[model samples]
Target: MRIISGKYAKRNLFTLKSNATRPTSDKVKESLFNSLGQFFSGGKVLDLYAGSGALGIEAVSRGYDQAFLVDVSGQACKIIKKNVDLTKEPERFKVIKTSDFRALKQFAEEGEIFDLVFLDPPYAKEKIIKVMNTLLENNLLAPHALVIAETDEHTDLPEVEGFELKKDHHLGRTKVKVYERT
Candidate 1:
């Protein structure tokens, strides 16, 4: 896959060779960023289930200050590093090879907060809600932070207390939603 816009526009990214992870398609990525106003002035973003590091990398390329790309798979972490290296600005990204929950805990321990978070997990519905709550509980989200989730059509996102559903888009079998902190 390739970056669709910003500083790294048109740059190709490498994905893992396993079926356990799915990379967001360029169409959806483009449309999602378009909905978020594409380029940003500065902010920190987290790719909670980062597979190929594409989404987080794209965010940084689009002007976010930094991106934390987290993946549970060792292979995916290596691929993430390769993709980050391709950007030639290694400082812009921090790749974590760990489970989603563990990454969140680490962030909490560090008192880190995010302006945006991506929750495209293996199973979306339950995990997404849990992560949202964890983000809220730990104060890991910046004021009015946005949480974006990409999931299968069958996974329906619930109305979490601290977040307001912003946009929901369905593309073929994929369902994407954006939520903002209330």
Candidate 2:
């Protein structure tokens, strides 16, 4: 896969060897950034279940101050590091090789808040609700922060406890939704 816009536009990224990871599509990524608009300027980003780290890398390339990438698999972590190096943005990125969503709480406790959060767990897993709750309970999101979730079109997302659904778009078999703090 490759970065679709910003300074890193057209830059290629490495992918994990395993078939378990599903990277966001170029169309979805472009649409996501377009929807973000001015929100991309100099803000912190958190990419949960980072996989190849494409989404977070895009944010960094577009001028976000920093991106924190968290993933459970060792291979995924390695691929994300490679992708970071590919972008030559090691200083602007942080990779967490952890297996639980709870670790995100530690970031929150450290007073880390993100302007944008990307969640694209494996399809059929229904991980969005659980992670969204953690973000809210930990106050890991900045005021008016945007959280984008890409999932199979059929995944059922509940009304998040403190988040309001801002936008939802279906792209073929995939669905992309944007949520804002209530």
Candidate 3:
């Protein structure tokens, strides 16, 4: 896969060799970012279930201040690091090899807040609502923060109290939803 835009536009990224991770396709990534205004001036990004770190890396490429990539798999973490290094600014990314929930808690403890959060967990084990609630409870989102959730067509995400659904669309078998904190 490759970064679709910004400073690192068209740069290739490495993915895991195993089937455990599903990397977001270029077309879907392009559409998702396009819907989010195509670029950012400055902000932090949290990439949970961060497979190959494409979402987070893309955010940094597009002028976001920093990106924190979290994944449960060791191999995925390695791939993420490789991708981040490819950006030539490893300092802008923090790669964590851990469960999404645990990372969320740790970020909360550290009083970290993000302007953008990307969720693309394995389709069969989607826990987006719970994760969103955790982020809310911990005040991990900055005001008007944007949350992008990518899931399979079967996974339906409801509108939660604190978040306003900005856009929801289907790209082939996958579904993409964007939410802004209310």
Q: Judged by TM-score, which candidate is best?
A: 1
Where is model 2 more than 4 Å wrong at Cα? 123-126
TM-score of 3: 0.97
Task: Give the runs in model 1 whose Cα sits over 4 Å from its true position.
Answer: none
Give the CA lDDT, 0 to 100, for residue 167 in model 1.
Answer: 96
Which model, 2 or 3, shows the larger TM-score? 3
Question: Please, what are the lDDT tens digits per residue for candidate 2 over residues 1-182?
Answer: 79988878898888877788988888888887888783366989899889999999999898899999999898899999999998776999999998556668678779899889998887434678888888888888899998998888778676776889999888887888899988
| Angstrom error at residue 157, model 2 | 1.4
lDDT of 2: 0.85
lDDT of each: 0.93, 0.85, 0.91
Q: What is the lDDT of candidate 1?
A: 0.93
Give the lowest summed-lDDT range of ten residues in model 3. Answer: 121-130
RMSD of 3: 1.2
